[model samples]
Target: MNDDMRRLVRVQEIMVVIDALQEKIASNPAEVARLEKDLLAAQKDADADRARVSELSKDRRRLEMDLMGIESKISKYQSQLLEVKTNKEYQAMLHEIETCKTERAALDEKILLEMEESEKRSAALRSMEEMLERKRRETSQGKTRLDAEAQDLMRQVGALESERTEIMAGIAPAYLQPFIKVARQRKGLALVAVRDERCGGCHVRVMPKLIQQVRRATGLIACDSCKRFLYVPDEPSRAAGAGAESPAQ
Candidate 1:
């Protein structure tokens, strides 16, 4: 590679590094945001579980109160049975006791069902709480690591920027503009190597004359198709020994 090509390649190397660091820095915030969202979602789930258990507990309390009221009514009816003056009165009092007892049994059954649901809800809430704690710890750790990584990437970007400035100064003004323009347009790729007699940038077959020019590094030769500058390495020519005896296979 010529001095200009070498310098441009160096600049490209630095730009690639800088671009990667910038991307990582840019993406770190998004990752942190995602982690925060995940943590929030877990907290919401835990809160819902706790709310469910709280509602079930309230229902259980209401059922117990109803059961107590029914019991009190049944006891009063039983006490009135001793003072009943007629068979009809006694029968009516006994029927009232039986009705209260039935209601009490139904309330007891409902209370039991509510208790079961409360127990399940409580267990689920506990599990969710544990999960929430774990998620919180994980999110915290992830943010810490991401922050550290972002800091390191910024440092690397600073160093690469300095190196890029030096390499840019080494390139000639005539060659620098095209490199910068193409690099800007092509996502930091201004030069490409010719391989198999094809343009590496667009993979189009290069004309023989242009290929020879690129190999000689006579001047910056742009690809016919992609218009990107071409390069050739210092490796031996593929056809240098084609007419000689073939090596033993």
Candidate 2:
């Protein structure tokens, strides 16, 4: 192909790479958001476990206080039994003492159950906290890696853009302007190789005359169907023949 066509092809190739890198950069934010969401869910689970443990502890304390109050009542009733003046009064005092003891026993059972539950919940909380810590570390590392990758992608795009600029400088305006217009209209694909007598962009067959003109590489040629610049790739055998002839010259 001619020098101008070669430069155009190089610019298109560079643009394709830049577009892919930019696409990856654009998707980074969504990936970061997903990481944050997982970490947040873990945090919420740990917080809920901590709250449940606290509630169990509070219940245990309340049950213990009730048990103490019942013990105090029983102690007062027992002391009065010694001063009773009649059998009926003494029996009544004994009954009151028995009722207090029963109440105290029920309170003790409740307190024991509460303590057991609190211990179980506390253990679960510890496990949850450890998991939360792991998630935090993983999230931090993931975000850091993503950030580094984004920065590297940006650098690659910058370098490719610089190369594209240098290639564009060597192309004439007459060719560059139409290429830019077509590339804009065709999603940055203004140039395509003609293969098997077909337009690579549109996959439509080209006339013999147009195919001949493209093979000659004499001027800018466009596919009739897609309006994209078309070029014939140098065949290996033809390139070899040209090389052999050039040595004679």
**Which candidate should be chosen as best, given lDDT against the real structure?**
2
Regions of candidate 2 where Cα sits further than 4 Å from its true position: 236-249
Instruction: For candidate 1, write residues 1-249 as lDDT tens digits.
Output: 666776776688778878877988999999999999999988988888888888888888888888888888888889999999999999999999988888888888888888888888788888888889999999999999999999999998988898789778877888899888988899888898888898888999999888778767656889989989988754455224322322221
Roughly what TM-score does model 1 have, to 2 decimal places?
A: 0.85
Task: Assess each prediction's global lDDT (C-alpha) against the native.
Answer: 0.83, 0.86
Q: Score residue 156 of candidate 2 by CA lDDT.
A: 95
- Which segments of model 1 are wrong by more than 4 Å? 215-218, 236-249
TM-score of 2: 0.91
- Which residue pairs clash in candidate 2? none
Tens digit of per-residue lDDT, candidate 2, span 1-249:
766777787788899999999999999999999999999999998888899999888888888888889988998999999999999999999999999988988888888888888889899899889889999999999999999999999999999999899889988888789899999999999999988889999999999899888878767799999899998865666444431232210
